[model samples]
Target: MCQLLGLNCATPTDASFSFTGFCQRGGATDHHADGWGIAFFEGRGLRLFVDHQCAAESRMAEFLRSYPLKSRNIIAHVRKATIGDVRLENAHPFSRELWGRHWVFAHNGDLKDYQPRLHSQFQPVGTTDSERAFCWLMQELAKSHAGLPSVEELTLTLRELLPQVRRFGSINFLLSNGDALWAHCSTKLHYLVRQHPFTQATLMDQDWTVNFAELNQPGDRAAVIVTTPLTRNEQWTAFEPDELKVFVDGLPVEVA
Candidate 1:
């Protein structure tokens, strides 16, 4: 299995802190050393980066450590190559245009014998089941709605679609379209929110600490969703088995 990391915030925030720990699984701390990718949402646009090298050795990953690209929504992944070759085209956090906005997706689990009938509107550029699933999802959404659907309506549609995909294998994923972030878990996932009374946080993978109280205002809030806790101090909540959650403006508003 691979590892996933995501963030949704009320204000633009850099993910260097959380990513420090998340990257460790790609090589240094764990054995998920196949490929890695990350995406940042800015307004209606998105910035994405991916590398075929292990996160610990990838120069792209090194740049990410210092690149303070702030964004309200972010999605990232480190692959262990359950399918497809360890190449850049097969990296996660794939992006495609939908509803006039960029939709980004990343998957952490493997799918077995998962081939879905898809339309030609969007096709997979890579051979990985992860990318194919993403294309299938976008294609389905496009066929389901003539125009952008309301959040409530779209959520209902997604709830129905996800189960069919999960039938193949583990289906943990993070998806975002600049407007909101959606996360689903078939096996393992966890999340946490930091709000007003922000406290200091220390990373578990590195010797670093930050006092959020000193950097954030009383109204500032940020939410982190990951496969595991990134910090040693802050409390993190684990997602229930086979659960799905949606985060809007950094807080989980819908959970199922």
Candidate 2:
């Protein structure tokens, strides 16, 4: 199994705080240390980093913890390598281009004997089931619409397609395209939204705290999703089993 983390914001925001705490689970506080990767979406471009080393000890992860790269959408994963080899290419948070927009995906669970036919343009570069699933999702989306569809429309399509894959195994995942974040949960997932009248929050996995009121403006808002609660002080809502939700502008939007 693995761990997932996602951030969506109304304004460009740095995920260093959340990422630092999440990285601890890679080896220090937890044991999903086979590999780790992250993707940040800046406008239409994407900055991706992957490493085969444990995130808790990787020099690259340490640099990322210090570097404040701001993005409206971000997805990260710490892997335990159930379905793939422990290599850079097999890391989660895989990226691809769809309708000329860069899309990022990360999975937290494994699939058994799950190999979907990928005859379209999208293909996996690695042997991970997670990558294969991502390519297949992109391939199907490309076929369903001539171009990028509305968030609502995309949600409908995903709701229809995801169950087919989930039948094979757990399919908890996070996906984003710099516009909105789509999260699907088969077992465990939680989310929190930080907005006006922000309060102080403490990390669950580390001895760290942050006062949102002091660091953010009144208009600033952010939505965070993870496989488990990341903060000890914040109220995190657990997603219902087999639930799919879409987040836009730092808030959950009804996509029916």
Highest lDDT: give the candidate number. Answer: 2
lDDT tens digits, residue span 1-256, model 2: 9999999999999899999999999999999999999999999989999999999999999999999999989999999989989988999899998889999999988789999999999989999999989999999999999999999999999999998899889999999999999999999999999999999999999999999999899999999999999999999999999999999999999976
| CA lDDT of every candidate | 0.89, 0.94
Cα RMSDs of all predictions?
Answer: 1.2, 0.6
> Against the correct fold, how does model 2 do in TM-score?
0.99
Instruction: Give the top-scoring candidate (TM-score).
Output: 2
**Model 1, CA-based lDDT:** 0.89
lDDT for 122 in candidate 2 is 90
How does residue 133 of candidate 1 score in lDDT? 90
lDDT tens per residue, model 1, 11-56: 9988888887889889998898999999999999899999889997
Poorest 10 consecutive residues by lDDT, candidate 1: 148-157
Clash total of candidate 2: 0
Instruction: Please provide TM-scores, in order, for all candidate models, with all chains considered together.
Output: 0.97, 0.99
